[model samples]
Target: MRTVYSEDHRLHDGKHELLEGQFMKVHESPSRADIVIGRVRSAGLGEIIAPQEFGLEPILKVHDEGLVRFLENAWDDWAATGRTFDALPHVWPVPGLSRGALGRRLSDCIDGKLGYYAIDAGTPIMSGTWAAVRASANVALTAQKLVATGEKSAFALCRPPGHHAGSDFYGGYCFLNNAGIAAQAFRDQGARRIAILDVDYHHGNGTQQMFYERGDVLTISLHADPEQEFPYFIGYADEIGAGAGEGYHMNLPLPWGTDWQGYSAALDRAMKRIEQYGAEALIVSLGLDTFEHDPISRFKLAEADYQRLGQRIAWADLPTLFVMEGGYAVEALGVNTVNVLMGFEQR
Candidate 1:
């Protein structure tokens, strides 16, 4: 598998983020990508190449124009406000507000725009965020282009993981929905159907919302139950897609302490649905946060379990693209991550 990455990802490092009403150190860091890249080289997976620029068009395909514009100008706007700290949204319209009232209130308010377009306060936007967000999207697109040309599979080592960002909202350490954008690109390239298997520890609420009403892309997420995880508003099994997308969206919300036996079974069910749907390509939202040693997530998946995880995905026998997402076990990140790719290669 070819690996797509860029050093520019180091630019968007935020100083801190809010967690549980207190400022906490950001778990998503540049060193996570560095360690994973080192493992890719140590394991001899494939060549690592800088991402080719795809411009803003591909990203605009999946994200809102207003949201994109805000991201590009956010740093300058915050600077103009004379705030030296990283900008974060503090206020949000509650559930009962009228749509027009909320829109009017958010339009004239920079702070409101921040909350309107953001789902959580964990992602802080500093001066250098625009460049890195664009670069990360390009990295995912580069891998998509390679996989589309029959490369068997490719790995997009995206930093500040994107499964949590949707078409119009950003949060959970994500700015742009990398996997969602890639899945849409695959469909635009003539693939009749695509399956996005999001195995992150936290639910990929953004990815699900992006395709909730579409049938061309099948999204299956296996994560901690929303009642107990971040992005707790959605990710229920009953949300089985809306119009033409009925039965296309699947959510397997497991409990916090799930082991490989339980996790693998959920994965098997996800793969079976993909087989039945006859998807032309497979996009795996590969988040290693499910690792037992991860500091920010729950689940008991050991390093060896990742190897099995890859082996099982190989059984599906489709063109696969693994887009990196969340994982916070810094020391074991490389070995645990590379093990998945190695298992797939050997399989």
Candidate 2:
């Protein structure tokens, strides 16, 4: 598989993020991509290339205009407040806080706007965030274009993992939904239907919301039950899309200690649905956080399991785009991620 990456991913490095209740070092770091890319080269996976600029039009396809503008100027708006640390939202409109009262263009109210636009406190905005965010989207888009135009498959080594970002909100160390953007790009490029399979340890709530009401893009995720994981909403099996997308969405929530035996059944079920959908292409929200050693995530997947996972995905025989998402076991990330890619190639 051809890999698309960018060095600009190093720019959005936030010093800390709120995990659980305490502030901790950001698990989603530039080094995650560094390790993955280094392994790709060392293992002779395939050619590595810089991302080509696709501009904002492709991003706007799956994101809100106001949200895009907020991400663009968020740093400057926060810096104007005279504090110089990473900008994080201190409040949120959760459960029942009268969210309808918030205005759309609150550029003058940075804090309020920050809360309105941000879904969680884990993602922070630094001086170079927007540049890196834009570049990351471009990275996913470039690799997506390669597959959409006829390559068998490609890898989008996106940083600041995106499966947790929604159309108008950013969090879970994600600013934009890279996998969502790529699926939208395929739609804009004329493919009638596409399926996104998220194998991340956490539910891809953002990607699910992006396509929850649209049938053209089918989204499926396998992750720890929301009752026990972060982003504790909307990953249940009951949220099977809405309106035209009624039957297109699926979620297979598993227990915390799940290993290969329990996980493979879900993968088989997900692949069966993708087969039923007959999508023209597939997007795998490739996240290796299910590794046994992941710091924050729970699951018992071993290194060898990733190869089987990739082999199962390859069995579908559709053009695929592997958009990087989350994986926090830094040392083992490269081996597990590359294991999936290598397995796909060998399969």
Candidate 3:
């Protein structure tokens, strides 16, 4: 598989994020991509190409204009107040406050806008965030282009992982929803039916929300159950889509402490759904945080199991695009991530 990468990912490095009622060093750092790229080279996994600039047009296809504009200017806006630290939201526009007139006025203040556009406090915005996220989206789009144009498979090594971001809100260390953008790119490029299989330890709430009302792109996620995971909302078994998209979306939420046996069973069911969907192409939101040693996530998947995961994905027999999502066990990220690609290639 050819891998699409970008040096710009290093630009978005953040100092700290609010987690568990305390500020801590960000887990979604540049090293995650650094190690994965190193392994791809060491394993000789075909070509490693820089991403082509797809620009904001493709991103706007899935994300809100206000959210994109906020990300693009957030650091500068925050810095204008003389705060040099990374920008993190201190407050959120909860349900009632968000729907009332207060939400409209909040958009004018940088502090208020931070909460207005963000879903959680974990994602910090620094000066280089916009550039990094833009490059990340380009990486995903480049890989999607490869698969849409006839490459058997490609890897979009995106950073500031995007599964948790929705069309109008950003969180879970994600800014632009790369997988959602890529799936839309596939549609724009003429694939009639597309399937996105998210194997992240956390649910892909953003990707699901983007396609939940559309029938063309089938979104399936196998992740830690929402009741027990981060982004503790949505991603239930019953959120099977709405309106024209009813029955088009599927969420197989697994419990905490799930290991290879349980994960593999969910993968089998997801694969079966893709077969039934008759999808013209497939996009895998490849997140290795399910690994046994990952800090923030709670699954127990071992390194070897990733290969089996990849092999199962291969059995789907569609042109595939793997978009990197989350994996914080930086030391072992390379092995677990490459194991999946290696398995897919071998299969």
TM-score of each: 0.97, 0.97, 0.98
Per-residue error at 32 for model 3, in Å?
A: 0.5
Model 1, span 1-347: residue lDDT tens: 88999999999898898987889888898889989999999889899989998898888899999899999998888888888889999877666653665343455567878888888889999988999999999999999999999899999999868999999889999999999999989988999899999999999999999999999999999999999888888998899999998889999999999999999999999989999999999999999999998998889999999999999899899999999998999888899888998888874
List the global CA lDDT of all models.
Answer: 0.91, 0.92, 0.92
* TM-score between model 3 and native: 0.98
Residue 306, candidate 3: alpha-carbon lDDT: 93
Candidate 3: C-alpha RMSD after superposition: 1.3
Error of 1 at 132 (Å): 0.6
lDDT of 3 by residue, 1-347 (tens): 99999999999999998888888999999999999999999999989999898779999988889889888989999999999999988877775666667444456889899988888888889989999999999999999988888899999999978988999889999998999999999888888999999999999999988889999999999999999888888999999999989999999999989999999988999999999999999999999999999999899999999999989999988999999999999999999999999999874
Q: Give the local distance difference test score of model 3.
A: 0.92
Candidate 2 clashes between residue pairs 3 or more apart in a chain or in different chains: none
Cα lDDT, model 1, residue 222: 98
Give the RMSD in angstroms, all C-alphas superposed, for model 2. Answer: 1.5
